[model samples]
Target: MTAKVAGIPMILCALGVFVGGTIWTIVYSFTNSKLLPKTQWVGFEQYERLWGENRWLTSIENLAIYGACSLILSFVIGFVLAALMDQKIRFENTFRTVMLYPFALSFIVTGLVWQWILNPEFGVQSIVRALGWTGFTFDPLYNADIVIYGILIAGLWQGTGFIMVLMLAGLRGIDQEIWKASRVDGIPMWKTYLFIVIPMMRPVFITTLVIIASGIVRVFDLVVAQTSGGPGIASEVPAKYVYDKMFLSQNLGQGFAASTMMLITVAIVIIPWAYLEFGGKKRG
Candidate 1:
């Protein structure tokens, strides 16, 4: 009884913090609140301005590119790595440990490390030039066009290991009899994986998709530590935009509106797929 009573307050406090905060933000989004929230309603003025800004639009575009490339590349690379590991090679545990070590570091650390490594003066480009490739130029952070791709590479390096581990676990869960039967039927390994194994791992894939999507949506610390939306907001992301508007720009209303749009964007991406994947089963 005592434990139950204690847990009730904890649950209520959590709900108050999360649910209450969300409601507060949403309510203030319609107002002209600046620095501090006020009850002066403005009825979509904040949203209109948010959508009108070029930086916000750029942020949205960057997120789309990053999210799409990250989703496809991470899954492909992770599955490929997982398949290789499933081959019963020597020193499998050592290889897995090495591969997954990057995921142990936080995004801030990963970003800082990659930032230094990708720096033109003292990093890869410099090393290559020192080795008689003076004509070579590989500076993504300085170039506005390809800056997001630089962030993508760093994100993939830090994230794919976790996805690979997940894929490997899914692979290991398959019955050995399935492999034997496929082999006996003279089915090629690739075909077997595509036609049989992958379909069986749908749940694992969906779980991984959700995790990666959430990470993509909330990616801010890495961008802050790495590029800081450099080269004139080229690598700007929605989360960073929200932070800047809320704190840096001192426009709480606009920030709230941007956050709401982000929530809407997530819902738009996730809802239909989720319905097709899980919701339709109830009707069936």
Candidate 2:
């Protein structure tokens, strides 16, 4: 009872800061708020303008591509690495450490490191050109057509290691009896992993999906640090758009509108999942 009483203030403060602030933003999004938030209501003008903007559209498209590719690739890479690690090979700890090292770095650091490595003048391109292949052009950051893919590479490098760790944990949690039973039944390793193991690990897969999906939506720092949404706004994400609109562009209404859309989009994804995962189970 005493601990519960002590926690009341903290809970109230969190509700005020997060829930209250979200309500404020949603209310202000309906107004024509500019540099300062005002009560001058403007209905859906901001949202209309947001959908009509090319940069926002580009950001949405880029996000879709990045999210899909990242989701598939990260799971594939992470699962593959985890499976290999599960083989009880020599130096397993050392290999696991090396695999997870990239995840230890912040997005900012990962972005900057990849930026330099991908730079045309002094990075991979130059090194390859110096090796008697001057015609080789691999500068994705400079190419607006493929800039998002470049960012995708950096994101995967920084993130897959963490996914691998999570997958390794999930793999470790599986009952050894299951593996032994499958082996005794003469079930091939791949078939057992595909048909039995994966089905059993649904909860872990869902958790990983949530984490990666959330990261995909909120990706901003890496973009800022790497390309600053540059190469002609090709790599601009929704989060970057929100920040630039609110602070840099001094259009609070526009930012709020974008943020509200993001919130709605997330809710659209999450609410259904929540219902299926929790609500349906409760009913069951």
Candidate 3:
């Protein structure tokens, strides 16, 4: 009873912090607050302004492109890596450690390194040219239509390792009896993994997806460090937009409004998944 009583206050305190921050953001979203908060309420004018702004619209579009590509690429690559690592292959620990090392590195460093490596004049492009491929040109980072994909590649390099770790954990936790049973039944290894293992790992996959989705929604550092919203705002994400408005552009109200929109967008995307995970009818 004492422990429960003591824990209640800490829980309440944490809830208070969360609720308080959310309310503060919501209130700021409704005002014409600049660098500093102002009490003057401007209703939903900030939201209206965002909708009418070209840059913000472009940022939203870019975010969608980056998010979709990152999510798909990360999941696919991570699953493949995890599956490959699960095989009783040589140097399993080395491969696992190599794959997961990227996740340990700071995103800032990842972005910087990738930026250098992808630079048209000095990186892969130059190296290819030096190899007598004079006509080769790898300049996606400079092209508005393709720059977002470049960012996605760098993001995947780091993000996939995270998903790989999660999937590996799920794979390790699977029952060895299932593998033996499949072998006795003459089921192919790939078929067993696809039809049996993958399905059983759904809960872990969903959890990893949610985590990656949150990262996608809140992605900021990679964009800033690598593209800085691009050669023409082609890589701008909602978080970057919010930062620009809050600091560089000095439009706190608009920044908070963008943040609110992001919060709503994330909620919309995640709520269905949450219900499916927690509220759906259970299967035996």
lDDT of each: 0.94, 0.93, 0.88
Per-residue error (Å), model 1, residue 283: 5.7
- Which number leads on TM-score? 2
Local accuracy of candidate 2 as per-residue lDDT tens digits, 46-132: 999999999999999999998999999999999999999999999999998988899899999999999999999999999999999
For every candidate structure, what is the RMSD over all alpha carbons to the true structure, in angstroms?
1.9, 1.3, 2.1
Q: What TM-score does structure 3 among the candidates reach?
A: 0.92
lDDT of 3 by residue, 1-284 (tens): 99999899899988889878888999889999997999899898999999999998998888888888888888888988888888768998888888888989888899898899999889999999999999999987888889888888888998788899899899998999999999999999999999999999999988998898888899888888888988878888899999888999898899999999999988987997888887785642
In Å, residue 254's CA in model 2 sits off its true spot by 0.4
Residue 177 displacement in candidate 3 (angstroms)? 2.0
Flag the better candidate by TM-score, 1 or 3: 1
Tell me the lDDT of model 1 at 90.
100
**Which stretches of candidate 2 lie above 4 Å from their native place?**
none
- Cα error of candidate 2 at position 95, Å: 1.6
* Model 2 global lDDT (CA atoms, 0 to 1): 0.93
* Cα TM-score of candidate 1: 0.94
